[model samples]
Target: MAAKPQLPPTTVFLLKTRSSPTDAYEDLFKAPNDAGSRYAPIFVPVLEHRFVDDGLAQIDSLLTRRQITNGRLQSSTGGKYGGMIFTSQRAVEAFKKVVDGRHASTRENATSSWPSLQDVPIYSVGPATTRALRAIKLEPPLQVSGEHTGNGEDLAHYIQEDYAGWKRPPPTATDGTASTDAERPGPKTDAQAAPLLPLLFVVGEQRRDIIPRVLMGDASESGPPHIGVDEIVVYGTGVMPSFAEDFERKLNETLGSAVRWVVVFSPTGCDSMLKALGLLDPETGRAKDLANRPRTDFIATIGPTTRAYLNDTFGFNPDVCADEPSPEGVMRGINHFMAAWTASQ
Candidate 1:
């Protein structure tokens, strides 16, 4: 009997789903059921915790006044049988509008908190994420991973492995006491031995807003920021093909040949495209079959709506596939991309 092939480690790919206000709410509510019990869906409620009591009452009044419907209320349980689950690509788009609107409002009140990149290694998810990181004066150590693998968990795993075999700098002796680097030990081989820079991976469209806030938070303190990226890359947006292309060209010029990278744009139905191109193995649900694919890369979306569209159409899970701006899972997917890029290099 032939030996069984080993499965590849997980890599995170951040995805953006474009949707309208109504549709986004519906999706958020229904995501729990749609994704089954394995994944938990979370959303920043529009109403503040303090206002929850009155807010719900007002919402009910609006519903009774014909001001809202099962579709208009953005309610997951508004219709019979809890209304139809929003599975259509178009319906998912309705939700993006709400999320984007909220993001814009929050950005106005946000600030950057990252430290200077003089000694930090950066990881990025897409071009926009890189831009945000650059605004804080940090240089990216590597290129963004272009292919969308689906979420941040995969990205984190990839980074851990890609830089796994790297050798750490020799420990400096101090005052009779020995101190060792806490990040990782020495590299496994000469080929794998390389200096480890600060790693940063940008995972979502909101990275533009999130990066600055993170940088600002980092800079406010005396010591280096607890959370920082050596590089940043974006995964999802929905502007236009021309815009994406132009952005890619500009980024290439900025980074020059110092790093390896690629940009993914308008990746709507990209899984199908990859399958069609033979870049992915449909049978195994993996991209290993796509040997001809680019290695290190950055992806950008023309607009928020486009990202939402791809998410809905592809049924991509934002929790696992896309990075949320919150500290918890924000850069998770981008980290996976960095791992893949490092391995390819």
Candidate 2:
């Protein structure tokens, strides 16, 4: 009888717990593709986050004072902040707590404490964050946007453009009547700048400053005017104490496969992930030689941020960096790597 070819190794995703039917990665690789490459996706929770009470209190104060709003009308009634920005699901969860806390008595009321803030623009980084924000019950519903941007830099630019127009007064028609100019808001003049409010960013203690830097950084001579951003640290993140052990247990169970992959999501779990893979040298506190390491082991990152972290911190370059931070993007990255590896072999 002819010898049969062995199957591709299992792949593990280092991420937090996600519910089924919604976890994109799980849904994507749930079955084998036409080429017959299948992945048994093992998700290991690497980080735990705790809400900061001080931050939540601040958000509550802003909400109660009616400070976070669309600065359409100037005066004491004008909201302190033009709108809100949410990038992480944890931050959204914290915001949800504050929103719900104030309206605990009126849980049945959909418009409960958020009536004054209904018109405020709530910018979300991606679909996950958007879903999280949408899940929160609020009156008039959350005016969420920027979900399609998929990352901070793009979303920041979107915010810069969208918010500028959002805060601008409707353009008056050349005629006496309000014209189609309402459909296309123009930039606010220098005279109108005084009433503009900065964006309120809800963030974690450990977060990328890309949004703030991109939005509020000094504008180039030809660039759009700088947009203001005010960030509140609403949560702190740390590696779970049991992460290393859990990763080791899961990895050992899958070692039977000749080829395996580890998809890292954040820098937070890089150390534990390397240790679990037996790639970290305890004495030297560095990764071992790739040549000496198992050829079957491969590493992938979800985005450039994590990829850059691995490269800078460990002198390690990932085999794949997903073009987009989506399940389809990850699949494309892995498949491309596999094709290149097979070709090289």
Candidate 3:
């Protein structure tokens, strides 16, 4: 009769915020009988949400400027908006805080153009973001007109293709003329009435200017086509001052303990975690980061964007990058990693 092979547990690091795939990783590491699972380590979480400061105050200011005078709403820009862009659910929730009137409870938040400007188009980057829009009861419960673009570059290109000309009404209701039989009015098509007002980008503090940079052209360029881009910072992001003492302690519990796997959600978070773990110097950051870490360990990135960062910045191609950018997708990546890792072992 064959005996069960008992082995020391491996240590795994996971850097992600709420709603990430941390749980999936936890479940995968629970069983030690699977091939290569013998080396499956105990998972440790070092990720935490950054302190969201001055978010509600900023939202209130935008709300104040968008005061509903009489029955009509007047915006700070003094014209109709071309459209709206949202890259993160954090931006959506910030707008939710103000629109839903939850200012007293939240610290960080998003911005709003005007309830009357509901006729304008709203674009989102991810499926979670699409769900956030539907949660706000923004009209139809789906993404409305555009395709669900998971990539930021794709989203930027789509916006440029759809709204660059600023022709035709930018679709009144998100669900195609409102779901109810309320007989919604038509979109404003009179070009002379409005000067193709800038689009409102509801974003967080850690945002990348991919959309604006791509659609509006060179940042250094000057003159009329400078493009009207009104950016509203709704949420804040920052890393922990240091990694958790408990995590460090666990790593040192056994002789020569080391991380066997790591899961990162973003490129920023990936570098941030390396810094937190002292793998990269805090002072004079390294040009070739993660050089000191062992080569045998595996890293799993949440999506292609983050994987690109790892490839470009650290010269480290992650062992796996989730194809769909979802919890299930992440699990699939882990499964694939296990299959290959098991074969190698």
Candidate 4:
């Protein structure tokens, strides 16, 4: 019998916080934010969640104890804390600049149109993030409740439903001529000539309503010609949680396995989406202007907590490259991830 191949040792990288390196490292396996310290390190743990649950549980317990004392608890007496913070001073400075610039631009736009922040629909992932957005006076459109950590999937669903009312002209014939009733090709009897399928952007859990009708391939004499879902784009925001396991089962029932998962890391919101469309700098990360950035089809933020979850759960590395300091550098990192992900697919 052939021996089983041994897997390589997984290396976990830690991104420590400037103010609280110790707390950050200690809570490396669970959600980084659970550490109760702003200075907690951002970690990319390379281990499956099942194998590292104990470590994460220990960290969560430590965090709970520390929260009572404001992170002053000791590791020996029921508290386990120790780790490193991975970040560059330059990156931190650049991120601040980006945030400030974005805020200024948003303020300007809001001032010209609506004076109240409540009028705008801000999209956010968690409570902390919603609070942050609210602090900036941006109203969040959607908020996920419970342990069901929200990711890009929710955003995609929102966008699809929001834009469902929009209608566009159908594609012209191959001859580049509009067809009159008599000149039009006979009703499409061949399956290949079926109506164009709706393009589905499946960021996480596949939403049935959002998938294009053509992809479903449901043919019925009693109902309207079913439009099937055509393409699916998968945005990797966090390790796909429990819902991901049954995704294939659900997908098989509708679109089958012909679909592909296009993974893109859109951390900076619409700016990242525009870059993917090849409209913005693929390398420099410079935008022609804020106006040109693609409106976020959906925004999925992998905060410290989500990042830790992904690292601990899938052995996936969050810090795939050196910490990027500039906006352009971040875009480049995103592009690199997209390319690698596409190749793997």
Query: How high is the CA lDDT of each candidate model?
Result: 0.32, 0.78, 0.57, 0.30
Candidate 2 residue lDDT tens string, 1-345: 988986664675646666433776787777766545788788888889899999999998898888886653343345678899999888998998887777885568764455366678999987878988888877668889988987999999898788877744443333433334334458644334343578899999988899989888887658766778899999999999998888888777877776778888789889778877777778876778787444877888889989988888777778899998877788888888888888887
What are the per-residue Cα lDDT tens digits for candidate 1 across 1-345?
A: 999874332221222322222323223323433212221122211111111224233323332332221121122223211011111122222222322334455566455211111222223333333333333322332222312223233333334443323333333333322234344577433222212223322223332343334432433325323332322222233333343334334444444333322212344445543343234445665544224655333332333444565456544322123343222223334345455665767
State which candidate has the highest TM-score: 2
Error of 2 at 18 (Å): 2.4
Q: Say which prediction, candidate 2 or candidate 3, comes out ahead on TM-score.
A: 2
Measured with C-alpha atoms, the lDDT of residue 280 in candidate 3 is: 51
Q: Which of candidates 2 and 4 is the stronger one according to lDDT? A: 2
lDDT of 3: 0.57
lDDT of 3 by residue, 244-283 (tens): 5545554456436443666787765566555434555446
Per-model TM-score on C-alpha atoms: 0.22, 0.84, 0.60, 0.21
Q: Could you tell me which 10 consecutive residues in candidate 4 have the lowest summed lDDT?
A: 67-76
lDDT of 4 by residue, 70-118 (tens): 0111111221211111012222222223344455665756544222222
What local lDDT score does residue 210 receive in model 2, on the 0 to 100 scale? 92
Candidate 4 Cα errors over 4 Å, as ranges: 1-118, 137-149, 158-345
